[model samples]
Target chain A: MFLIDPILNVCERLGRRLLMLFSIVGRLVMFAFHALRDVLVPPYYPKLIGQQFINIGYYSLTVVGLTALFSGMVLALQSYTGFARFNAESAIANVVVLSITRELAPVLAGLMVAGRIGASIAAEIGTMRVTEQIDAMTTLSVNPFQYLIAPRVLAGTLMLPVLVFIADIIGVFGGFIVGVYVLDFNPYTYIQQTWDFVQAMDVISGLVKAAVFGFIVTLMGCYCGYNSGRGAQGVGAATTNAVVSASILILIFNYILTQVFFS
Target chain B: MKNFKIEMQGVKKSFGSKDVLRNVNLDVKKGESLVIIGGSGTGKSVTIKTILGLIKPDAGKILVDGQDVTNLGGNDRDEYLKKFGMLFQGGALFDSMTIWENVAFGLTQGQKMSKKEAYPIAIEKLEAVGLKESIAQHYPAELSGGMQKRVSLARAIARNPEIIFFDEPTTGLDPIMADVINDLIRKCVSELGATAVSITHDMASVRKIADSVAMIYEGEIIWHGPIEKLDNSGNEYVDQFINGRAEGPVKF
Candidate 1:
């Protein structure tokens, strides 16, 4: 009985922590649903939407493009070295393009954008809330959620897929450059093999993932910003929470969607 | 002339175990400027926020133009909000926007006016606040502190709202700039015939802008009367606050 006491205490503590984590996630899910419900019924702001499109889409292109390019190049080099040892060097092109276009392009682009754009959105809105700009907007008969959150979320959903599409093309081209030029593979054969193995489902699946990742990123950012407490410390805490939550949710959703699509 | 513009009754707000506002009651007549003076953390800002429905009171009634606004939500709250304007303590201008755009934000975004329609009104408001047309193109970051406050003031009056709130309007300004701002606040409120409610500890601003004054202590209105009667109000808290003495009921 004495030996069991310590074990039981540890179990109880772990159970309590898990329950708290679940409650927090549940509250966030409920908040996201409420935001979506509000979004569907709108006195929409086209100008604000356009502004956020530039913010979430155009501004994020550089980081996502750079990440995809390097990732694809490295992937090709590693695959070529491994396949050559097995006298399967011709399979390098197929591996690189299929892996990049199907998975890395969307996931890497999503995560990079989540880190860059998600933190900015949270900090910007959190500062506004702390400084009373949101209240001022309310006093001027403007709905802060409609003006701020809706536009960012809409832009995120629309823009990420476009970004992922661009990343997919760029990443494949990167792989091609590495394979044909550096690895001394025949350009014609590499292109043919890549085209043969890459299917429409792969591209479509990547786009779907991009869209879901966008939703998670924007929702997490807006939620943290809107609920930020008071002062500089509160805003700083919100920014950190936004990035961590978005990154985790992106990975979790990626796993679930992959299972549903492939399993 | 005697109509009540804003009124509060038995407003009580508590944050956790600490009571910030304790049964505060007050009134402001039309076309009058009321300045609320209190020490830091005595709920001066909370009182105003409650009236604007930014913070819901734990127990109270707030009335603007005879309509109870304490529990209004959605479209009703939005409609109620249209009649008010506020100048935040930090100016709170969008950093990405130019001075003219900041001033015209409500006109263009909230009222659905085109840029062409809004820009001219924004320039006009800027001129009224003594800013040149050239300054209109500059971002808030480019402006000096005094200029930023003036731009904020212009933005607050852009919609010609009937009720205006200024929260610590002159807290971090140089004495000369603070005086200039106080004069501008007075001119704007009177010229627009707006009912103004300001919360501040700046005695110079209070004397320059307020027609009436209320002193909040421990979340309650310890003293309230016309500005002319403030010196002789006989309330120890009011006397201590206005005189800037540390040896009174309000401890540092």
Candidate 2:
């Protein structure tokens, strides 16, 4: 019995951590369910929803656009360098547009938002949690989920697609500029190559991925913050956890979604 | 007693292994100011929170106005919650909102009153709490702690709730400010003819505001009597607690 004690201790610790992880996931699912349920109910706060749309969707446009433009320019240059060895330099614009629209723009935009909006949401809600404001709202007969989580989650989901749409356009334009101005390619040929290779499905799949990423980012923020432990330390932990978890989920889901749509 | 406005029977709650409230029982008569007094962390706050439907008891029945509220939910819970108001320990006013907006929250959010309709009522409540109308535009952070408490009180009594719960309404205040808050609490409760339940470790708060007193110790209601009978409670726990004794049945 004594000989097995160390092994037992290790197993017990591992088992406990696994149980805790499962419990956290369970709580997150329940929270998402309740938030979605509130979305379908009456007594909706349209004013709050509109404000969240602006905060989550409209404000995110700039970052998405900047990331997409730089990513497309880099993609054209790098693909030109790689393809030049094989005498396939003409395919650079095709590769740039495809990569930017199908992968880079959505993933980069999601990561950027996960860093920016996710941290802000978590900090704000975490402070509310610590200060007993959330409790006070409950006491005042307001559903905290309805007032807080639903609007943010719904706004994130609805706004990310629009941001990605604009990003896609900016990204292709960037590819055109880099190919013609920097790579010594014909502008008309670059545009034609981009238009020929990129299909409507490529754009639709990226938008779908962005929407899911948006949901993941906002949900993680709300969950971590809403369940924040206590005081400043807890809120700080929550903000960090929101950004980290959202970024991880976006990366993980990006691969999974790509496999689904492409494979 | 059918006349009891709020009653807790065998209320029990625990966080993990530690029991916060253990077999706690109490009752408040209609329109009475009942002050629950105890040492710090003696479950006084949890008791009132359970009554307010914030913390559901692990085991027991809680009745409000002769109706069991232990399992209230959905619209029923919302309707039940409307009968009461609470002033939190730290004066938990919404930091994101202005003083008037905080006061008008339940009015606009719960009662469905338009902001235009609720504006005058918010100012009126602020005035009733002795706050000037100029401060209505200021957020909670801009105010002094005493001013914040007063604003919280104003928000609490805005809708004239029939039952009001004060959680440490005077904890961080000086004697004068504490007494001022106690007076506001008493005045507001009386004006609405509302039943009041306050939990505080502050004896000064009890002396100033209580019609009845309950002392909780080690997760139990060790003593409960009228304020007049408190000096001669004839119980060791109450005796030690009120007299500020370090050595008695109350073990540190």
Candidate 3:
């Protein structure tokens, strides 16, 4: 009887937690829908979108570029060492190009952006929420969904692909530099192998993943910030949640997208 | 059959298990300055927020000019919202914008006026708030608390709104600065012929700006009367609140 009661208690607790998780996801989905609907309406702020583009896409360039470069270089070094043990060193270019284009560039850039842009969006909007700036916006007859969330979400969606495309090129260049300079490989042959082995679908899939990850990052940020609690503690918690949730979603979506594209 | 600019009938709101407002009933006349006085967490802010459609009441009807605005939505809500301006307690000016841009936000963004057209009006509003034209380009963060509050007031009046709501307009200010703000509020509302509703705990501000006063205690209006009758109000809660007495019907 005692053992059965403990099992029932555990089940009840698990059920409650599951309900809470579903509630949060439902609210997030509804928020995204409203934001997207507002984005299609009139009163579009091209100026705000431009500002967010600079913030999310341009400002994130250095960190994303650096991360992608290192990831690609590491991939090349690791693959060379691993394949050398199996007399499969000739396939190094194919592995490097495939990994960089299909996985590393998009995922790394997405993570970096989720950390940088996601945290900033949450902090800025959360502070505004706590300080009553969002309320002030509503009082002024401005739809915050249109004025605040739409521009940011739109920029994140559009700019992420661009950032990832740039990252893809830089990442490939990093792999090439390591493959040729460090590995003592013939640069021409390595380039030929990369061009021959890389498929258009691989790069396209990564860009698509980048776009989705971008949407998730900004949406989570807006959701967390808009519903932030009062004061500094609330804003700080929101910032942390935005980054953590965005990073997790990016990884989850990466796998799902890879399945859809390849599997 | 008095022409009420705003009316709340049995309006109640609760957050989770806590009741913030319970059966709140009030009325404001056209072009009248009605100050709602209460201690913190007494639902003074919630009452005004419900009127503005920022917070939906759990139950009851809110009528603005004889129209039920309880469930207004979509374009109707937007159009309805256009008639009023609100001054948030924290001087909620947009930090991203310059002082002039903050003032002109409603004009440019809400009314869709071009920047060229709105700039002059923004400056005009700023100047009306006793700020110089040179400060127009400065940001809200660069200003003092008093100046920022003035800018928020400027933004509120920029649209020539029919109704103006001030939430703790004189809070966090020195006595002289608070008086200056109170005077500005009175002058602005009178000049615009706007129905003004303000929430504050400051007796001095209440005396300075209120044509009529309503005292909220524990989410309900305990006493309401003309400004002149505040001192001699028969209600113990009102007397306790006004006299700053710790021992009264109002619990800590």
Best-fitting candidate, scored by DockQ: 3
Cα displacement (angstroms), candidate 2, residue B36, comes to: 1.1
Q: Write the per-residue lDDT of candidate 1 for residues B133-217, one digit (tens) a residue.
A: 9998899999998999999999999999999999999989999999989988999998899999999999989999999999998
DockQ of 1: 0.61
- Backbone clash pairs in model 2 (N, Cα, C under 3 Å; residues 3+ apart or in different chains), count: 0
The sequence of per-residue lDDT tens digits that candidate 2 reaches over residues A1-263 is: 98799999999999999999999889888999998898878678999999999998888888888898988888888888899999999889878878888898899999999998999999999999888888888777788888888899998888888889899999988888888899899888888888899899999999999999989999999999998988899999999999999999999999999999999
lDDT of 2 at B46: 91
Per-residue lDDT tens digits for candidate 3, residues B163-213, read 999999988999999999999999999999999999999989999999999
lDDT of 1 at B25: 94
Better of 1 and 3 by lDDT: 3
TM-score of chain B of 3: 0.98
- The order by descending DockQ is 3, 2, 1
C-alpha local distance difference test of each model:
0.89, 0.90, 0.92
Fraction of real interface contacts that model 1 preserves: 0.72
Predicted candidate 3 versus true structure: per-residue lDDT over A135-241, tens digit per residue: 88888788999999999999999999999999988888888889989999999998899899999998999899999989999998998999999899999999999
lDDT of 1 at B244: 88
What residue pairs are clashing in model 2? none
